[model samples]
Target chain A: MVDDNTLLERRNVVKKIVDHRGNAKIITGLGSPTYDVFDAGDSHSNFYLWGGMGGTAMIGLGLAMSIPDTPIIVITGDGEQLMGLGSLASIGVQKPNNLAIVVLDNGHFGETGMQKSHTSYGINLCKIAEASKFEFFFDVVSNNDLENLIEILPPVKGPIFANIRIKSQNPPRKLPILDGVELKNRFRKNLGVEPL
Target chain B: MKVDDIQNNWEEKLFSLLLDHKIDFLPYVPDAGHAKLIALAEKNKLLKPVVLTSEEEGVAFASGSWLGNKKSVLLMQSSGVGNCINMLSILSKCNFPFVTLITMRGEFGEFNSWQIPMGQATKKTLEAMGIIVHRATHPSDVCPLVDAALYGAFSSDQQIALLLSQRLIGKKKW
Candidate 1:
């Protein structure tokens, strides 16, 4: 197992990926506290991967397919990732080159509580990625490997997976920038809103 | 094929038809009867597949996509048809243009008692919601009918259903 110091690093990996992929968008998940990152970050990314609840990857897959040639990176949690594991197979079969999924597997459902997840089963997530036919996959537990991995991640074919084993850490939480209704309105204005 | 050339058992064909029409946004809850279509749809780059945890979520996602100015479709099983009634009513009351491709179960030689109720009430329920339900029984009926549904969904600004019968799917592996 890697040392503990590197396991909990989040900002450096995010910064490296943001720096490397100039135009790539960071689509955050529901369970993750990413709005703060997006609000504070230097880069301007329009987040649209929210599927009301447990369909993060599905939204990523949809956006990836809808706009070809634009790379999409999903920063999702273990519990959130498990919500749509079927999408791994679905996205894999489609083999969208512009898609990259990074699962922050902290071994718990961190949002609601640090509850034990199926990851407690010691599931080989990289193997799951392989089963989904992702050409390149990495299960990283060290922060030192983060920057180097980001430099080499893109320009790969099909979907790429990174099961970055993170530690459960709850920093001071940020209130949701937009309430569900306001979020809907902001998303409409930002992404072009249409009727049902 | 012309939009009128659509028929049942045309799951894959309908998929290609959807691509041809440039209808990209898709939110689907897996349906046994529409398995082939869903499977084929997963491979299409033009159509984005959004798999929902439940049928209602699919509707909501599709609704969001619609608000985003993207044409969206919801693929669900007959059981999901029941789950979507409230949301579907919202779509109708708002005159929303959304296409629902429903896989019919509980009818024909359906051995699973679980599928019976949904299969029996699917069409009536859809009609009760003011949705125009089209039953596609032949393989050839799927594409054209779907085109019509898509057209109706957009032109009429209404919700439409393409109810795929069990005969279209044949037998279930499980």
Candidate 2:
């Protein structure tokens, strides 16, 4: 196992991704992934999930399909992605060109007290994405792979999938509006959709 | 009309309701009861048919589709409802408009003993989670109830599940 200090810091990973997001909307998985996104930068385009544990990627797929002109990125955790592994296969069949999913895999369930997760025990999520028919799949273990991900995020041919390795260290939580309705309405409002 | 003709007629009318209202996104897990409608949706250019790996994914997909300002419906069997319990929390919490067409199993003369528990528990389970549950016991009741569900869901932001009872769907002969 790699040392926690030696692995890439999760905060910087998020900062780089959000810094280059351009006009893309983001959907974060529940828990630490939400914190990571908010820590990077907050925007009305960010749809943060407070409790939906496993639906992050499919939501990106849905958004990409409906709003074809806009790019969609799903930033989620290894635990959340593992819960929705079947979604990769589902998204693969559609292959929506506007959607990209980046799982910030720290190899531990960060939100659940740093328990060693399946990814920690030799499970390869990028392989699952590739096998599931994601045309652009990346295993970001180094800075070059990370740069490559940012380069292709715009004008991308998805379904694109990437698994980025992060250190198993907890950062102070930074929460956005935890109210689901407000977060949802704010997100839709920014997209020029009427509040429900 | 024969029994088969009446059943087909009801299915067609419900399918037409979705088309007429421009419900462009349909996410579904294939079921015997929804087979014909799924087939029709697959062929229609106006509808984007998304095949989900599980029923819960449909809940998330529907929310995202709505966020993008599109009408989305989920189609699943009574058994699949069990998979959606937790994911459906996003709908009620966010007040996201949601409509799902659920075909009942383990009802009437059902032979599959395994499906009985979830089928019987489906309505109460959904209702417990703040979802309005409506059941269509006869072929004639299906379209009207579904139309009402679609209206309440989108216009009023109500989360509703339309249960097409096994009695309406008829017994599956093995």
Candidate 3:
């Protein structure tokens, strides 16, 4: 379990990660991760899941498989990740080299009035990823660990899973475009595809 | 062709149709009825066959595939259709094109009481969720309906559910 004292602020960590992201398509999980990614700087390439709680990781897998040469990252919260934990096993089996999943472990369901989550009690997401056979697994707790993750995430040749311990603080909501069609078309246009 | 050979040919034909439409991502939950199609997808070097843990993930995977300008198709059984209701909302709301080939169970079957409820509800449930349901009860109808579903999904950006009836795939022998 991650010690609370060693946790980093979610926004700062997200910013650092996004800053280092070089031409990688990002899929953000619902709630905080979506806000965090938008806080970093909105891009046409960022596909925010405004409501799909458990489907984020597989979406990243699909994107990774579709565009094999490009990097794909899924940034989600612990609660959301737990809801779709089965995705880890599926991802492990496919073994997509261009995919990475980063979990912001605040140990609570921030979307639901700060209710305690499984990670807060004893659920170890990094261990779960390891057991699922992720090529790289990191339980990040400090600045140096975060830096190491940012360095290794983009170019990693296999599925990489990282659970970064984050402080539990409710930042003001930063909502992106809620219309799914518009979001899809913009993302497609960014990929140089004609919008349907 | 022999009787058994003809049955296998239909499955291969469906696979070829998907390939013709440029579906590079194949996400599926294992179903006996789809075994031949799944096997063909696995052996194809150009297609990325993903084994999904649940039926719902296939929806998201297909959505992501489309967002990246690639096409995908999901394969599951009738029972698995129940697991996809909530996720189907994402497809409808987002106007994302979804194509899933479902194998019917519990219909025209002599066993497995548990599969009956979902089997009966599959078509209505998909319809309620605003998906266009297409069923193929005979071997000859398989390729054409699948072709239409694929065209509707991609060209019109519609959610299409292609249900393969038990009569077409043959009843499981107990």
Q: Which candidate has the top score in TM-score?
A: 2
State residue B152's C-alpha deviation in candidate 2, in Å.
0.5
Higher-ranked by TM-score: 1 or 3 = 3
Q: Per-prediction DockQ, in order?
A: 0.18, 0.84, 0.77
lDDT of model 1, residue A66: 54
TM-score of each: 0.68, 0.97, 0.96
Per-residue CA lDDT of model 2 for A20-72, tens digit only, reads 99999999999888998999989999999988788999888888888999999
| Better lDDT candidate (1, 3) | 3
Which regions in candidate 2 have their CA more than 4 angstroms from the true location? Answer: A1-3, B1-8
True contacts kept of each: 0.05, 0.83, 0.75
Report clashes for each candidate as comma-separated counts: 16, 0, 0
Model 2, TM vs. native: 0.97
> lDDT score, residue A54, model 1?
47
Measured with C-alpha atoms, the lDDT of residue B6 in candidate 1 is 26
Least well predicted 10-residue stretch by lDDT in candidate 1 chain B: B1-10
Order of the predicted models by lDDT, top scorer first: 2, 3, 1
Worst 10 residues of 1 chain A by lDDT: A42-51
In terms of lDDT, model 2 sits at 0.89
lDDT of each residue in A9-122, candidate 3, tens digit only: 999999998988898999999999999999999999999998767999989988888898999999999999998999999899988899999999999999889999998888
Q: How do the residues B44-157 of candidate 3 rate in per-residue lDDT, one tens digit apiece? A: 987768898899999989998888888899999999999988878889878999899999987975378889999999999999999999999898898999899889899989
